[model samples]
Structure formats: C-alpha cells, structure tokens
Target: PHQKTVIDVEKDILYQNDMLAQRNRGYFDAKNVLAINLVSSPGSGKTSLLERTLTDLKGEMEFAVIEGDQQTTNDADRIHATGTKATQINTGKGCHLDADMVANALKGLKPKENSVLFIENVGNLVCPAMFDLGEKERVVIISVTEGDDKPLKYPDMFHSSTLCIINKTDLLPYVPFDIEKVKLNAKRINHQLEIIELSCTSGEGLPLWYSWLKSKVLAPEPV
Candidate 1:
C-alpha cells in the first residue's frame, strides 16, 4: 500500500506538470518564440555559452533569459550584464524548474515575438530531466573535465535532450576525456541526438552552434 501511494503521488505530480507544460507550449507557439532549455551539471559552462551567444548575436536577434538556480541570482546577473532581458528563479529546496515556475516567469520576461528565450535550468542532470518547461528544444551540455561515461550514467537526461553540447574542448589536451566515446555513448542513449563540440573560451566551433540556432529559428512553423 505504501509503495502504491508513493507511485500514485508521483504520477499525479507529473500529470499536473504536463498539463501546464502544454499551456506553456501553446504560449510559445502563439508568440512564435523559440524557447530552449539548457541543462547540465555544475561548472558545465552553460552560463559561459549563453554569455558568448548573447554577446556575439546581440543586435541581430532579440533574446530573453530565465536563470534557474537553487540559491543565488548569479547566472541571471551574468545574463543581464549582456544587455538582454533576464529573470531569475531561485528554486530553494527544489531541484528543478517546473512548468508553473516558468509560466510565472514568462509573465515578466515578455520575450519579443520571434525572439529566442533561453531557460538555464539548475545545474542538475537528474531532476531537471523530468521537468518540461515547454521549451522547443532541450540542450544538454557537458564539459571535457567531466567523464565521458556521463551519458551512460545519466541516461534519462541524454535520452530527453534534443542536442548535446560538448563544451570546454580546449582542455582536451589536458583531460583524459574521450570525445568519440562520449558521442557513441550519447548516440546509444538517443540516436537522434545532435552533438556539437565547442570551446567557449577559444571560440572553436561556435559558428556551427550559431548556425544551428539560426536554422531552428528560421525554420517554418509546422502546419
């Protein structure tokens, strides 16, 4: 009886979140906003990538950001420094940003039509995978310092993400990580997962990332 109750509670919680996620998806579709959820473990360079993207693409496209963290507003502050609109959501004891939190944040963000909205989820590979923030794309980022077996260890995250970014490639010479092995592992989890290897510090492979973003934004809406 106890196990059944726990499972029921979990299902109910997920059901509620899924309904709200559908609403969020509708909102984004109505506004033609391309919302992308950035997920990763701590120190994975998600913020660095966002800073670079915002700085390099400034003036070309309007962007808004929602920074999610368990404690401080540091990430939001960094995003704001780039002159882009950003709102911070401190989850406190919560591990992930749920659809309701994002729904509330969207009220203040008011991302422009046809603009890109980046929701930087809390640096967690586990809990965040289960929450859908109504994003058009979910990107998983991993740094070279992290082990190549991350995809296999965090299969849920790898299975859920649409794209996997291999960041901090500049440290490849110093780290023991294997790029090909990581790609294979990620592919094993999700064969359709698009992989992009880049070094935010060195600007390597950034253009490809930029092009991918452009392609998504420029793609015609589905009928």
Candidate 2:
C-alpha cells in the first residue's frame, strides 16, 4: 500500500509538471525563442561552454539565461558579466529546475523574440532528466574526466537528451576515457542522440557546436 501510494503521488507530480511545460512551450513558440536546457553532473564544464558560447556569439544574436543552482548565483553572475540578460534561480534543496520555476524566470528574463534562451539546470544527471522545463533541446554534457560509461550508468539522462556533448577533450590523452566507447554507449541508450566533442579551453570542435546551434535556430518551423 505504501509503495503504491508513493508511486501514485509521483505520477501526479509529473502530470502537473507536464501541463506546465506545455504552457512554457507555447510561450517560447509565441516569442520565437529557442530554449536549450543544459544538464550534466558537477564539473562537466557546462558553465565554461556557455561562457565561451555567449562571448563568441554575443554580436551575432541576442541571448538570455536562467542559471539554476542549489546555492549561490555564481553561474548567473558569470553570464551577466558577458553583457547578456540573465536571472538566477537558487533551488535550495531542489536538485532540478521544474517547469513552474522556469515559467517564473521567464517573466523576469523576458527574452527577446528570435533570441536563444539557455537554462543551465542544476548539475545533476538524474533528477533533471525527469523534469520537463519546456526546452526545445535538452543537451546532456559529460566531461572526459567523468569517464566513458556515464551513459550506461545514467541511462535515463542519456535516453532523454537530444544531444550529448563530450567536453574537456583536451585532457583525453591524460585520461583513461574512451571517446569511441562513450559514443557507442550513448548510442546504445539513445540511437537518435547527436554527439559533439569539444574542448572549451583549447577551442577545438567549437565551430561545429556553434553551427549546430545556428542551424537549429534557423531551421523552419513545421507547419
């Protein structure tokens, strides 16, 4: 009885979140915004990648950010330093950013039409996968230092993400991580997953990432 009750409550919570997510999607569509949710474990270089992306693309497009963290507003501060609009959402005990939190953030962010909105979810591979923040793309990042079996270990995140980024490739020589093995593992979990390997510090393979972003934003919407 206890297990059934807990399961029922979980389902109800997810149902509510999904409904809110739909509303967020509508808002993004109405504003012509491409929202991307960045998810990964701590130290996966998500922030670094965002910093590089914002700095490099600042003149090309407008950007807004919602930085999620369990504590400080450090990530949001970094984003604001780039001259982009950003708002911080401190989740406190929460491990993920839910749709409702994002909806509230949007009011404060007010991202311009035809702009990109990056929601940097709290660094956790598990919980973030279950919540739908109404993002157009869910990108899961894994640093080479975190090992090659991340997708196998956290199948839910890998299965849910649209893109898998292999970051910190500059350390590939020193680390025991296998790029091919990780790609294989990720493909096994989600064959449709698009993969990108890049090093933020060395600036290798970043152009492809930038091109991918532009293509997605520029792609015509389905009628």
Candidate 3:
C-alpha cells in the first residue's frame, strides 16, 4: 500500500493548494486585479519581456511583479529598475512557487485595484505546471534557441498554459528552429493555446502582446 499512501499524500497536497488558490483568486477578484503567471525554462526571457512590458505600458496602467527564483533577488532588482513595484520570492530549494507562497507574497505586494499583477514563476517548465498559484491567466515562454520541440518535450507545461510566447525571434535566421513547427506541435498538445512570436531586442510582435493584455484587462471575465 506504499504507492497508495504516496498517491493519497499527493492528492492531499493538491487539495490544500487548490483551496489556497481559490482564496487567492477571491482576493484578486475583490481587488479587481488581473493576475498573470509567467512560466518558462531558464533563459526564456521572461524578465526581459516583463521589463519591456512595464516600460512600454508605463503611465498606462498600474503594475506590480512577484519575481520567483530559487536564490537571488536579481530578477526583482531588474524589474524594480523599471520603476515597477516588485517583490522577490526566494523559493530556496523549492522548484516551484505554490499557492501558499503567492498568498504570502500578496500580503506584501498589495497590488492596487484595477492593476495588473505579474507573477514571474521560477524558471522551470516542469514542477510549475502542477501548482496553481491563483492566476487568472498563464503564459509560457520558449526561446527560439531552446529548440522548436519544447511543446512535445514538456507537454504538461504547454497544455496548462493559456498562451505560448516564442521569444528570441531575432536569432531565428541563425537557429535551425522552425516557428511553424513549434506552433503545430503546441497546437497538437493544446488546441486553444494562443501563440505569439516576439523579439525583446527588436520590438517585433510586441504590439500584439500588449494589445492582447489590454483586451484581457478591459474585458476580464466574471470572477
């Protein structure tokens, strides 16, 4: 019965996490905050994308960031450099940020009403997929240099994510990555996944990303 015990413990953990996530979701709803969880592997350019996003959208909307890392606050520092309020959650040995951690961070972040809260999850495409941190939307980024078959390799992450960001497109000419192949592979895993190709350096396809964010904020569904 060891396997059964392990399964039971896993279920208990998820059940507790789900409860906390619902509480977190309710808090976000009460504050009218649009929370987006950004997940990806290391060097996927999540920080760069957020830096640009906060910079370009400055004076347009109130924004806050919860940067997750296993150790340093470097990412949060970078985000703060953009003049956006940011809190770093050092997960220590944990590979992923759970609902409890996010709920605790929320107390300090205190993102204002009608503002956007971006949670840059730990740079891991594995464990993050199983934890729901009470986000209204989830974005997964994969750099072109990371190969085009990421969707097939990390099906859980791609399947759970609502949007897939293909970053580092400026190097596409040099890389053997096929953008269309990535889209097709991801779609095969998740037909509803919205894909966007962007280059943080060249500022290509960013307008569409911004427009998508605006539409989600302006037309948020009932909580």
Candidate 4:
C-alpha cells in the first residue's frame, strides 16, 4: 500500500509555503514596501505597540497593517482608530498566518510604495515560526509579565525571529521577570537576535523601537 508519513506531508507543506513566500518577497521588493511580521503569544502587547507606533509616526511616515486573528476585527479596528490603513484576516481555527494569506490580504490593503507594512500575526509562537510570510524582519514580542524562560521553552520561535521586543517594562517593578535572564536565554538560542525593551503604557524605550522601524524602512531590503 502507498503511504505518506507526517514528516513527508509537513515538508511538502513548508516547501509550498516557502515558494509562495518568495513570490510575496518579490512583490514587496518591486513595490518598495518594507514588510515586517510581528509574532507573539496572546496579550503580549503587540497591538499596543503597533497602536502607539502608528500614532507617533503618523505624520512622519506612512504605514499600513495586516492583522491576523482567529476571529473578530478588533485589532484592525484599533489600528484604524489610529488612522492607519489596515486589513484583517480572520483565520478561524487556523493557528497562524501563512504567506498565501498575507499575499491575499495585500491585494486589499494596497500598501503604498516606500511605506512600512506591519503584519501582526496570530498570537501563537509555534506555528508562526514555521511560516515565513516574506517579511523583511520577523519580530517576536514577549511582555515582562511572561516568564523569562519563554525563550528557552519556545526555542524555535526565538531562533527564527530577527528581533524580540520585551514589552511592558512598567510592570517590571511588580513582576518577577528578569530582563537579563530573558536576554541570556534568547541569545543562547539565537546569537544574532536583536532585542529591545519597551513600555507602551508609559512610552519608555519606545524611541529606540521607533528608530529600529525607521532604519528598516530606510533600508527595506533586510539589513
């Protein structure tokens, strides 16, 4: 009897996804749009960071967002409230956003040339790590309320991400999260992982985050 193993099917799925991702990359390159994929566990302040970013940089640079969630357009509504163009993809039972999904969303978003395109992926660290959406950078957000051992627990996510944002710094005084420990653990998994600490509530460390985004937008080709 003919049979296919789970690994075989998984490999085929990833290969197909990667191919589509490359096509998305080519499109972004031709359009001169800087796309960033933001992945994180739920309630990690990904939406808050984006809201503040869009509000702060509204006049300085044009930005658009593609929000992925299991259901509801709540996050996209928040982004729209900040006056940024946004498209929402309701993944239903899907755990993560794939390149094909982003490609479809881009059609409706119609992102402007030379603008920043942020993809707020579904709030799951594991699945998103396996799907590259042809973004210039993959950013993982972890709030201070979460354990420092998260990087160790989710090595694949940390390893695949280009940058990690340690958010909710204002809660550090109340929470037991250790920034140094988180950094050490993440670095052990990914030596080249760039990290930034910020508090979206109080605006601390936000300038550095904004600077990082600006740099990426200026470069746009993955530096």
Candidate 5:
C-alpha cells in the first residue's frame, strides 16, 4: 500500500519471519542468487511469465523456481517440464507464502552457482506482499482481464514491487485496457516503479520483458 500504515505492519513481521528472511536472503546472496518473488492473482499468467523467462534465459544464467500454491504441485510440474529445476510449496490453509516456507523449500535443492531464483507466490495479491521471502526484488504481474485499475486497488502489491508486469497484451484488442492509463495509475502510486507489458501467448512485446530481465539478472555485475 502507498500508505505509511502499510510500512508499519511490514516492519513488524514476526521475529521468526525476520530471522528466516535474513537467513534466506543471506544464503541467496552468498551464492550470488538473484531471487525474484512473483506475485499476482490466479490466471494472471504467472506461470507463463516464468516459462518465457526460463526459455529465454536458460543458457545465459542458471534458473530455478519455487512454486507456491494452496494445494497442488501443478505449477512446479510445469516448470520441470520446461527442463528447469523447481520446488513445490503447498501452503495448505495459507493464502500467501512466508519466509519459513521458502527456507524449507530450498532445503533439498542442489546448489547452483550464480543462480537466479524465482519464487512464484500463491495466487493472491494481498497477503503475499506482507511477507519477505529473501528476494532481491519483488515483482507483481497484472493482466488486462484483471482490469487496468488494479494498481490503485491493490496498492500494497504495487508498492512492494520492484517491477510491474502487464501480461496478455494481445487480448487488448478485445479488452478495454489502457496501457498508458495503467502505467500512469501505477506510477502515481509508486513513482519509481518499472513496467513491462507483453502477451505470453502470442509473444507480442515479449522482447521488452526479456531485455528488462537481462538488464537486471544477466547484466555484468559491478566490475
């Protein structure tokens, strides 16, 4: 959320949560891991975004995923089907993923040097933004079908995000979504937000996403 009250709550996450988040982030940093927490509602194309990213970045950098869901391993299976490593975190009764769950999920993973880890949060826009999973960046994905006003409606998700993705741009022709308006609304909430809008099915504007990702995760580290 853009409100100061939001920070008040985030700053006071449980001690266990803070400890684990720090530990996990430290583990990631020690391995040169760039962890990205991907958050959005179900059907917002979170998996599609991951699929596209892994396909384009596999050769350039080590990639893996932690799929969070309320009950199944479906998302993880899809990630594995793409020939990349993946872990499944079933939250059972929980709607969002927390650091402890993430730390537990990574326990069985074989160490990948210089890896880029992607944590796909349980499909929700609210609770997920409250917990930190030791990610270097938090990314939120929204689609036209979900509405262009999503940023203002879910300001917490947008405010916590390091980048915002507008998926399913190809559907724009049949939808009433406005790219400029969405960007404007998102920026009004978080003026420094970075955005990328693209269609997962048709690949329209996908290059922009890939390029943006490369600049963040694949670009040469400070020399």
Candidate 6:
C-alpha cells in the first residue's frame, strides 16, 4: 500500500509538471517571448552571466528573469539591481525549478514586446537537467573552478543544453582546469554544443558571447 501511494504521488507530480510546461510554452508562443533556462551547479556564475548580459543589452531588450533558489531572494535582489524585473521562486526543498514555479511567478509582471526571459534555475547540475520549464532555449554554465571533467561526470546537463558556457576564465590560471580537456569532454557528450568561454570579471570573450546571444534571441524558430 505504501509503495502504491508513493508511485501515485510521483505520477501526479509528473502530470502536473507536464500540464504546467504546456501552459507556459503556450504563453511564450502567444507573446513571441524568447525564454532561456540557465542551469548549472552552485557558484557556476549563472546570475553573474545574466548580470553581464543585462548590463550590455538592457536597452535593446525588455529583459526579465525568473530567479529560482531553494531559499532566499539573493539572486533576485542582484537582478533587480540591474533595473530588470526579476521574480524569485523559492522552491523550499526542491532541487530543481519546474514549469509550475515559473508560471506562478509570471503572475505579477507587466508584459512587454520582444521580451527576453532568462530563468536562472536553482544551482544544481542534476535535477534541473531533467525538468523542462517551457523555455525556447536552454543554456548550461560550467565554471573552470568546478573542474575540467564535469562534462564527463554530468553528461545529462551538457547533452541537453543548447548553449554551454565555460565561465571564470579569469580564474583559469589560478585553478588547474584544463580548458582543452573540458572542451574535448563536453564535445564528446554533445558535439553540437555551442560554447562561449568567457570571464565576467575581466570582460574577456564577452563580445563573442554578446553577439552570439543577440543573434540567438533574435533567431526565429523553423517551422
């Protein structure tokens, strides 16, 4: 009876997740919103990357963010500092951000044109890889400080991502992360991965990333 109950609960969660995903996706379709879900482990610089992006192109895009964290509104606070409307979703014990969390958070925001919605999922490389939050694109960020072999160890995240960013290149010298090895391993898992190696602190490689992002957000989906 206990096993049956557990199974039923899991099934319900999945059903709810699916329904929310469809709804959120439909919302984006109607508004022509280009949403991106950014996933990575803690300290992977997901928020920092978004900060840099916002600073550079806030004038061009009506940018907003859905900041997911297990606790606290710290990340949302940072994003709000940039003058972008950011909604914080505290997932209590949840390790990942699901579609419902995003849908719920979207309630209070004012809609805008050609909006770029960046959902910064809770810092966990595993669970976030499993849940699709109705994003048009998914971006995975891995920092050099996290080690070079993360791609091999966490293939699911790397494989599912449309864009892979290698952050903290400014700290590459201080750390023993082999940039070449990281690329090779990541490509092994996802040969088609679009990688942007950049350091937010030094502004290194930002131009390439900036251009790539502008093109991507503006790129229309093929029918």
What tens-digit string does per-residue lDDT give for candidate 2 at 15-116? Answer: 999999999999999889999999999879988999999999988988899999999989998998888899999999999999999999999889988899
Clash pairs of candidate 2? none
lDDT of 3 by residue, 84-180 (tens): 9999999999999999999999999899988999999999999999999999999999999999999999999999999999999999999999999
TM-score of 3: 0.97
TM-score of 4: 0.95
Name the better of 3 and 6 by TM-score. Answer: 3
lDDT of 5 at 35: 89
Of the candidates numbered 2 and 6, which has the greater lDDT value?
2
Q: Arrange candidates by lDDT, highest first: which order?
A: 1, 3, 2, 4, 6, 5
lDDT of 5 at 138: 91
Worst 10 residues of 4 by lDDT: 214-223
Task: List the global CA lDDT of all models.
Answer: 0.95, 0.94, 0.95, 0.93, 0.87, 0.88
User: For residues 1-223, what per-residue lDDT tens digits would candidate 4 score against the true structure?
Assistant: 1356777888999999999999999999988998999999998998999999999998888899999999999999999999999999999999999999999999999998888899999999799999989999999999999889999999999999999999999999998888999999999999999999999999999999998888887644553
- Show pairs that collide, candidate 6: none
How do the predictions measure up, each by TM-score? Answer: 0.97, 0.97, 0.97, 0.95, 0.90, 0.92
Candidate 5 on 30-133: residue-level lDDT in tens?
77778899999888999998988788777877888899999988999989988999999999999999999899888886447577888999999988877888
Q: Determine which window of 10 residues in candidate 6 has minimal summed lDDT.
A: 214-223
Write model 1 residue lDDT over 1-223, tens digit each, in one string.
9999999999999999999999999999998999999999988999999999999999888899999999999999999999999999999999999999999999988998889999999999999999888999999999999999999999999999999999999999999999999999999999999999999999999999999999899444566
Higher lDDT: candidate 2 or 4? 2
How does model 2 fare in lDDT? 0.94
> What global local distance difference test value does model 5 have?
0.87
Q: Mark the regions of model 3 whose C-alpha exceeds 4 Å error after superposition.
A: 219-223
